[model samples]
Target: MTYFVKYLPVTTGNSTRLYTDGRDYCADLYEDLRSAKKFVFLTGLHFMAEFGLIRTGKPSDAVATLAQVLRQTGERGVQVFLLVNQFWRDESEVITGGHPIRAKIMKAGELYGYLPETLKLFDSLKGLKNVHCRTDIHPNSDIFATHHQKTVVIDDRVAFLGGIDLTYLDGDRWDTSEHTARHRHVDRTQKFWHDVHLRLQGPAVEFVRDNFLQRWNHGSLHTIRKKSLNSYEAWSQHIGEDPRHVAVEATQDRRPPALPPFAQKSVLSYTYPADGEEPAAPTVQIVRSMPRKDNWHRQKPTWNTNRSDEWEHSCKEAYLIGIRSANKYIYLENQWVADEDIWAELAAAARRNKNNPDFRIILMVPYEGLFAAGLGSNQELFIGTEMEDVIKASRSPATFGMYALHQHDRRSNVQGQIYIHSKVLIIDDAWSLIGSANAGGISLEGVRSGRDEPDTELSAIIHDKAFASAFRSKVWSEHLGVPVGPTYDVHDADRFRGLANKPGGKLRFFPGYDNIKRGVPTWFPESLQESRDPLRIDFAKQSRIIPSLSRDLLASGLPPTLVRAAFTARVVPSVPPGWRCWYRWHCQLHYDPTEPSGRDPRRAPVYLKLRSLKYDRDEVWNYSDQDSVYIGKLSAERINAETTTAVLGVIRCRVKILPLDEGPNDPGPSMVLQFECMFLNDRFARGNHPDFVRR
Candidate 1:
């Protein structure tokens, strides 16, 4: 049985603007923030204080930064409300050690930075009489779960929502497909990032505004300072500050030039798309995974409660409905996907049309984890393998294919893989859902036991084909580096293949190495609407764990799966050799009618998991032998009259073989290699011919 429930739809007229990544999204959001004349309301997982939207390094310094603009707007008597999620996690545990109880106390004192890097931007705003900031933790919410809604509703007329978090992962996030790593400084914590965001207007945005106030009016602020920042006692009194009652009151001293309390907010009003930009005709609905328990109760509730709200899980329901109703195909981009119900639902959709043989599910996720689930991130690999196996074994009519996106400079060959961090879904190019919630258990589940409850999340549901079609084209254009105009039909399969087969594509697609025999249109990714993948993708040459310690495979009594103990010697001083990874990448693919799987010389990931060799014990580092290594047609030979494939073992790795043996106590010179594989979409098509498949 699948998770399905009818959700009462909150429908309204709306206008929307789609953004590819933080580059344009943040810039546009900055414009909206600076332009708002009345009030600014924002909620997010992380409102990073470290100047995210302001490009201080670039030439543009004309406009004020977001902080300065926010301050200036608030100073003009405009009400500003910021609700940030401040859940607990010993975030600084790596850097700062502490005693348990005392550490908790000290962490509370340093409240602004204690959360998961979410709410520092508004810390300085507490002083402003007009700008109100509060960090929220639901009385029933698991301490490990925080509010993960990324939204902004300005003047009650415009809204911004989606997967783009306001943080500086680095300048790499700001570049186009033709990326240059000139600003690449990996050590400084600025790694290139990629994400998607959206802008909204009309009645639909009204719900976005109301969501902020509902939480704001019910929300309680916890301030650390002793003195009140405002001259009048209204601000403190409103926050339930009883000066005479409790001597240990949580009071805050007023900020610079301390003005009297600002006027209160009443009836909210604003014009749609303020500048009179034409509003899109999309019918939109505001969907959310908001808790039913509003800030209604007066007293601060205890840590965790089980008071379920009216809105059980509207966001999750929305996803199930979309997947179940998808007729032609389902295109998705997400950060994490650990939902078994949704996977089953998609498989069911495939099974429904098995006789006719045509249902498509194109999913794009990070080739590796975005930091949460690494290549070796526990059960993800296991579950992923299971999902793939289920789709193949069932022989369902649905064609499920997944691919990772990458971009490389032609000259320097500095390949930058575009991380699919957007939590997005477009069903049959008719409906779209975008927001902060992941497809994983943490963000999708309504409730969970222990410390693994779902984070507070928000998403917008757009049912307009016009809006969804435009959004899909925008994504495809950015990826393929070719202009797919607004009128490109979403239902056209041959057109997508024709465009895909044509020469130039800025972005490169890498189907999972195991998908070689699936014989689907691997070249044309999910964004491009294509027909069912012909080949069912069946292959089995799997071996990801092989790093036997030379000293003794089991001499130290460590299990066979581990490649541990590089340096552990109390008396004799004997250091074990590090892991050496070896795996094959099947390239120059051709139809081998003679082979049982219809494919020979398969490519599989060479996985190596090593722990505490020189690093910390708690963390496991993942490395692939074929990472950044480019494998092409080294030379293909015909095996039979009807089949040909790349000669096995011809694509040898140039990277130094592991097992650094430079004496007993020395970690030898570090070896580095970059790899890239030419992913084949069709085995028998003219595109896979030697003349078309280039270096």
Candidate 2:
């Protein structure tokens, strides 16, 4: 499989450097900031100006902070913009339906606040004409969703995007890749901080620049009582004023900032231009998950005809495409894996390669203790149990493995698992994706049931073989306590699995089942689960085209007969009877994982049973011959595929056939429909599929 996908755009002449952990990223970021000649734009979910960037060689005053660096840079006439997520309001100020704890904390002592360092930073930066600091709220108005993207663009020449945040509280995010534990105090102690950040040096930096300027200049439309939310004001003002005294919400309108002279071109224009060929240089593309609203930015749309106000879920589309394209192996590491859609795709891939002895699906996440610290829900246990059932029912139960990282201090008999905060996905040692989004519904498929907005996210799809393979080896070597060489080649899946089970390595099987018996604690209340790690999603399975299928056909001005002739001729060869497949129309579709059968015609799940196919010669369609056609018998009793009628018209538009490795000679279809993420449950979704269903 190739690293680049034809539908997605790719930018050439870009250089990339990877940081496996936060310590190295901070060092490089500090030096880069010190060398800045033009301007700097930085944003993150949590931005702490007090975060140390360098060791000053004194025990009492041991390091220089990010605030110091920003001060020094501003003194040199460098324009600086800092945009950070704003979730907490001062005790005296509050917005409508904002921050659940605000009312309670105010009633207690009238001194409620979070992240005092942010306020300190704002006060310190006062009167610095070259530096600007602002707090941004997610446009969706969903109190739970946040602006979670961590991106930095330096001088419009280099950019960094990944999961590493610029704050440290109970856990220091500045820990080395080794995950060493050197002290017991919160300030001095270093917990394992495993993350991935990419530094890009080339024209691709414009994408990062565009994203920042859009968020930075978006005027605040939210209101507190009658007053508009402040975006260009001091944080300390909120602390001084009383929420009860504020009257008539005043409007705060902001104009879009001027773009750099060199950034007049759009990133979409840099796509592969030559037909039937690609550029000789490595490439990169930026993808984002912006909400349906907030289209006030000055940047152009990704598509020429599409409006900027339309919802953009490019990050989700990238993940689904990457997972389905893997041939040899798929490696995933993230803080959480609660997204059922992602799990469904992974299970389908495992089923396809169950009989291939060399195929492997490896995953790494935080160990039990650390996992529980973030949230109370054991989502991994629930999803992991279903996945095990899927693989166990298959012939190759060992094809899928889940492990976590652990480090032991023999001297003090203190041992704990290294927190796996990185969000990364690598496929076949050829392509990779790294960014701030976790493998969960909140990060990927945003805006659950009652929520109004999705968490804003940014990720880059990279197709450079050298960078992908070398970074994969570096991460694997750290987990297995061995170097990547003859014994541990990048393509050697068997060796990687063998080393994961051996002692002395940091990797250990995630004890999901055991944690069930002992019980995982819910540090937060049950009501907050949806807010912390949202699980509800209502996305359509086949809705990710560059342009809507119906619009494309209509805009072409082609007659119905010619349109059907063009698409119907693109079908794959027939598989055996009883093989599961997806039967979908070209219209808009919706699937709700929570309630699949509840009377909504649009939300009804669709699946089919392959009956037979009569080929017309080969790969060609002669409409005159009725016998030369493909047919799918609707016989699934569980999903009521035969009885449940959809309100929308259904045409025999497309069918994705999954060829179970029934015998040693059978190779699967070249292209797959990949609409199975909308399956209702385990029985119909995984076990009832072609490979694992009992005959």
Best by TM-score: 2
Give residue 268's error in model 1 in angstroms. Answer: 21
Model 1 lDDT per residue over 392-485, tens place: 5334313655545555445555554556778888876677888887776557653333222356677877777887788777776665556777
Off by over 4 Å in 2: 1-8, 56-63, 88-113, 182-190, 219-263, 266-268, 272-280, 294-309, 369-376, 393-395, 409-415, 450-452, 486-505, 513-695
The worst-scoring run of ten residues by lDDT in candidate 2 lies at 539-548
Which stretches in model 1 have alpha-carbon errors above 4 Å? 1-6, 50-63, 89-94, 97-120, 123-127, 138-143, 169-190, 219-221, 224-281, 291-311, 355-358, 372-379, 393-398, 409-415, 450-452, 485-695
Residue 219 lDDT in model 1? 44
Worst 10 residues of 1 by lDDT: 565-574
Collision pairs in model 2? 226-248, 226-249, 227-249, 227-250
lDDT of each: 0.47, 0.54
RMSD of each: 17.9, 17.8
